[model samples]
Target: TLRPGHAQLAQTARLADLEQRLARVEQAVGATPAKLSRLGVGDHSLLATAQHLASRAALLDSAQLDAAESRLTTLLTKLDQVAEKTAAITGSSDPDRDKKINELYELAKKTEYLSQVLPQTLERMLALQELHQQGGEFAKALSEIESVQVQLMAKMRSNGETLASVEEGLKTSFATIKSNMEALDGRVKALSTKK
Candidate 1:
């Protein structure tokens, strides 16, 4: 007689083995991009989201926060498209599978919210950049803000409690960044008036 725990362990082992086989198949097929293209799985909107992220990196490198924000905004649209396309591909025929996919879709929406908040945060950074007289302090603050953005992005991909904690962290970080930027803006303005 198999114990319940033993049965659960066996199920887990089977799942792991199946995942390994699926990965190998994907690797073999992925190596031949042209074949996949011909088979009509190419041009996925998910790739478009990746392309937007690449462009966002370039924008950030150039210190174009506003442009980066715009790019992220557009990426949100692409994310929506990808979610819908994915749902169409893996239709809601099975209740259990549909529930799992719905979670992914919800995550995408949350990512869009993060993207929206990111620009607002970056705008605050841009305002701080205008106060270049405090270069060192401003740069350090900017670095921290960017670090938060990275953390939030990573958290958005996580499941359950980690994701919830990161979202709350982002809210706090944004509030702090905004408050600091406002203070700096006021200080810069006062100094300019004195000059």
Candidate 2:
């Protein structure tokens, strides 16, 4: 009893709903911290390492999801076209009318299954993409932090070298002053002995 147009409309609505859900997931992922602090990841280095691992994993998952989505899309399009053609021929006295109806039924079932399952897969793909984005951002931030730390260490080393130089200069000046003082004391003692 279902019309072709009605089935298409229902599928379209389902797709729209799936899209909205994906958008929400994307927004949530963006809003959360990249460090995954909620998951008890507290250490900076650990978070950086975890993000690196996650980036690779997400990349692989996204690629797989892309392939699956593409295949599902192709299958869905073919099914839709076949369903339309089958529905068009239903009114004709074709010898394979019953067979065509059965085929149409089978297509509808497959289409419904794909409609139900594809959204979940797409949702996962979107979430993985968001995770990949976050990992990249975290890696960039860690890199910046490391650069700053290196600059700070270099500055500290320069300051230490300058302090050592100053200390050596002070030691030299003190030694010269002490030598001069001893020589003057020896001269005064010789003069006092003559007196």
- Candidate 1 C-alpha lDDT tens digits along 66-158: 777889999999999998998898775689887888999999987887887998999988898877658888789999999999998777667
- Once fitted onto the true fold, the runs of candidate 2 whose alpha carbons sit more than 4 angstroms away are 1-112, 187-195
Best by lDDT: 2
TM-scores, one per candidate = 0.20, 0.38
What's the C-alpha lDDT at position 32 in model 1? 57
Error of 1 at 181 (Å): 99
Model 1 reaches what TM-score against the true structure? Answer: 0.20
How does residue 121 of candidate 2 score in lDDT?
100
lDDT of 2 by residue, 88-126 (tens): 876655668778888999999879878878999999999
